[model samples]
Target chain A: MNFIYDPVPWVINWLTQLLLGWGLPINLVNTLLYLVGAVLICLGAMLFTTMLIWAERKIGGRFQDRLGPNRVGPWGIFQSIADMLKIFTKEYINPVGIDKIPFNLAPILAVAAVLAIWAVIPFSETVFGANINVALLFIIAIGGLGEMAIILAGFGSNNKYALLGAFRAVAQLISYEVPMVIVLLIPVMFSGSMGLNEIVQAQKIPFIIYAPVACVIFFICSIAENGRAPFDLIEADSELVAGYNIEYSGLKFGMFFVADFLHAFTSAIVFTTIFLGGWQGPGVEQMPVLGGAYMLIKTLVVYFLMLAIRFTLPRFRIDQMMALNWKILTPLALVTLLVTALVDKSIPHEMTLVRIGALVIVNVLLWLLADRMITAYRKRNPIQVVTGKARPLARPEILPVVEKEAAQ
Target chain B: MTGMQILFLITSAVVLFSSIMSVTAKRMIHSALWFVLALLGVAVVFAMLEASFFAVVQVLVYVGAIAILIIFATMLTRRALEDKGDQFNRATLVTLVIVSIIFAGLVVSLKSWAPLQNLTSPLSAEQLNVGVLGLALTAPDGFTLPFEVTSILLLAALIGAIYVAYERKEKKK
Candidate 1:
């Protein structure tokens, strides 16, 4: 087991023994060591986010054929640091008539929720934060905090536009989450364990190879949750004027932006952990530090995929987003979950190749069916026309034009 | 008090206080926010009890779904937009009386249970984990009856919601 070879737990064990050897109290030593570990994880995530901001902008810039930010430092690698300095010095804005408590609380709450999700993510075999038995549920629960932040920010701002934007974004969020959670059940059923480490260990075969449909559904829904282009209606800058966080300014706005960027990468990391074989690579078990490197590389690849999707797609109309969730993704995810569960049940646990093959066939069929159904549904009832209706040009409406001209 | 007991007391206090404030807050939205806080405190209390599954479930179902529902409903009602308004009627005494009666009954029932006399040791993590919870939920002769019934109830609720939202088309002809 990689757990046996992983050095993090061994290091912690060694530290505790060192403390005990030095005559420090046992419970206190254990508690202090845990605190340090948790703090280090938080720092790690934050530090990663700092670089991620630069990397994403660079990727986005290249995609758009721009120079990106080459001014600050070499290739603008220090752009995030410079941006942080600037945002730190900018004046904060409160704008009178806002609800004080929720207004102030929203930004921090948004960042904190994303931070909390890291508690369960297994970086390597023995390098998890909480590793709780119900880590999957814990992630879902922690997600509520982000939703609450959006609602509070919109309502607390006392702006009509903000409130309307909040309504739209929250609706989008809650609707998409239904499929996201349902899709999550596929992997949980496959592993038969909810602890993230257990899920990783169970994936001797990466889950994406087994349940591609669920992975695709999860990816789409997570993109909505992360709120980037296409699903980025929350900050649809052109129409809604920055949506729910419109009233926020300066560091407060910066906090929300940081959280947004963090969440995108976090979702990517989670996708790596769940769908790809996390930290599972050649020489990882022999040299456990390689596991961390493997995990990082996989996460960056998935995150780059997210960035590509974000930069490529056009924004979705609100109604189309809702229809996609309700009419398509939700039903597809539910069917996938059911089929996967059945496959898991019928196969002996030892028959790995046979089980994967069964799941893949079921997923392919369901994918084809879902695609056909969507195309057929669209043929029957296309999207409602948004622009003003056009009268028949040859009119038959020429009579109305002549009558209006005569009256004038 | 021990550290665990102290943590328990703090979380309980948070739940109790936030719940009272949730009922008393003037704005409906603010009240909903307070209700969320109270739910989170209850989740913390569950964690303190070493019921991590229940703790997360409480947050997932209540804080995520139910509280969001309440807020959405409040947003739907135009009256909930106002910060200052008459939120309740003059029959405060009647509600107080009804509430006290229920509280007293609960106290009396709890006092009668012998197992409640002393706190038992916390269950091992494995015993209280998702495996046990899953078995307890779906195993035959266990909670399977209630489990299946709940699923049916949820389906009924979904159908009812769809029915309510169905719009009839009046033919232009």
Candidate 2:
């Protein structure tokens, strides 16, 4: 079976033995290995973020059916790096009438929250940065902090547009977080654990095969939670200019940009773990270190698939977005949770077929129920104006005349 | 000192400094910021205690949610940033004296206490990943009650937050 081993440790061990021949302690060698791992992960996350930015633009373009960022490097690979350099050297404008303290501190907090979530994630069984018991909860909790930073950035800017965008972003974030948490409960229920590593290990048959409804809910909520396309109403360029980051420029903007991409990447990896059978592939079990390689490849595949969806889907309106969560996703997640609980508790753990059948029944029921709710909602609240005793619809041009009449 | 002891001292110092500054800061926002630092220090202490989940939740809820909420409330309720507030009064002196007494009492008590005996050995990667934690949370006789209770608590918090933050829609229609 293929197993993952952190190469740094093996290298360090060899080096330590060689150094012990020259009289050095093993503890120092171990510490050095840890430091190296930390540095590598940090640099790796940064590089990954940079690459994702380029990948997103290119993928987004192809979905829009056009070429994107082709000039910076071969296939626009270096585009994000070039953009980073430009941002770093750009003029740092501290606009007047802004709260200087919170204004400056917001970006740092934003990036810090994103990076913090990465610490507990098990990239591989052997390569977890810190395999905390509550890895899942920690990821969610730390991820939530980014909203506060955005809100602070908006309010501290003293710009009216920025404040409006900030509040909207906060509303969007806090509202969607509920369904996201509820959806995450599915894996936790099925696996009967909250730990991320536990969740991954529970996917022997893949939770997606059992809790497909929850998988769909989790994926959609994740997109909205991360503020990506379609659900990216928080940072809607056409509507809110640049949303919360409108007033920010230079490296401050860079930090927000990088943080946003990192959030997306992390979300992608997380979805892979919960729904897509993380790190498990055919024939990958037999090779050493290739297990981790397979896991990474799977994560990247999930990431690219997310990018594909981003490019392909049209952005939902804020009202439509919330309706999808509340009316559609939330109810579906509830059913999935109920079914998983029932299957785990009632059916024999050995009876895979029965469990699978029950799960399928639950998902099918949810889909039909969702369709019914939509149709019923449509019937109850028709788009066309009803005739009985309704106030006359105001004409756009005549509204000014009516206002003048009121004043008179 | 052992590594854990040094870490405990550092984190405690940070928590103490931040708590003091949180009350004493001149600006309201500064006080809120200091409170975030203090809460984060508490999270680190939780991590040191091997309660990783609690540590993450502490940061997620307190630093991420409550602190931001405080800053938002301060900004919304106040006008332009104002002058420094009084740092200390007679009540503060009394509180400080009581705090020091409690601290000294705790220190004296801890001097005679034995270190906690380790029960479980350090878990292997395979065991740590899904085995032990999974068995604990499930398995009928394990932590199912605690798990469900936490969910209930989370639900209560969510509903309470929504109710507290709710505003009535304007009656224009």
Least accurate stretch of 10 residues (summed lDDT) in model 1 chain B? B164-173
Give one digit per residue, the lDDT tens place, for model 2 in B10-129. 999999999989888887777887898899899999777665656777987887678767876776765524646567787988998999999999988877666533334543556544
Measured with C-alpha atoms, the lDDT of residue A82 in candidate 1 is 90
Give the runs in model 2 whose Cα sits over 4 Å from its true position.
A1-9, A15-23, A97-101, A237-239, A382-408, B80-173
Q: Report lDDT (Cα) of residue A300, candidate 2.
A: 84
Query: Which lDDT tens digits does candidate 1 get at residues A1-408?
Result: 333566687788888889999998888897899899889988988888889999999999998889888998899999999998899999888878999998999999999999999889988766778878888878878888788888889988989889888888888888988999999988898888888899898887799999999999999999999888889888877788879999998899988989999999999889999999898888866777777888999998999999999888898988788889999999999999888888879999788889878888998999999999899999999877778777667444466877768766
Model 2: pairs clashing at backbone N, Cα or C within 3 Å: A1-A285, A2-A285, A2-A286, A2-A287
Which docking band does candidate 1 fall into?
medium
Q: Which segments of model 1 are wrong by more than 4 Å?
A: A1-7, A383-408, B171-173
Could you give candidate 1's per-residue lDDT for residues B1-173 as a string of tens digits? 87778988888998899999888889888889899999999889888888888999999999888998999998888878785677678898899999999999999999999999998887986788678877998899789999999999999999999889877576333
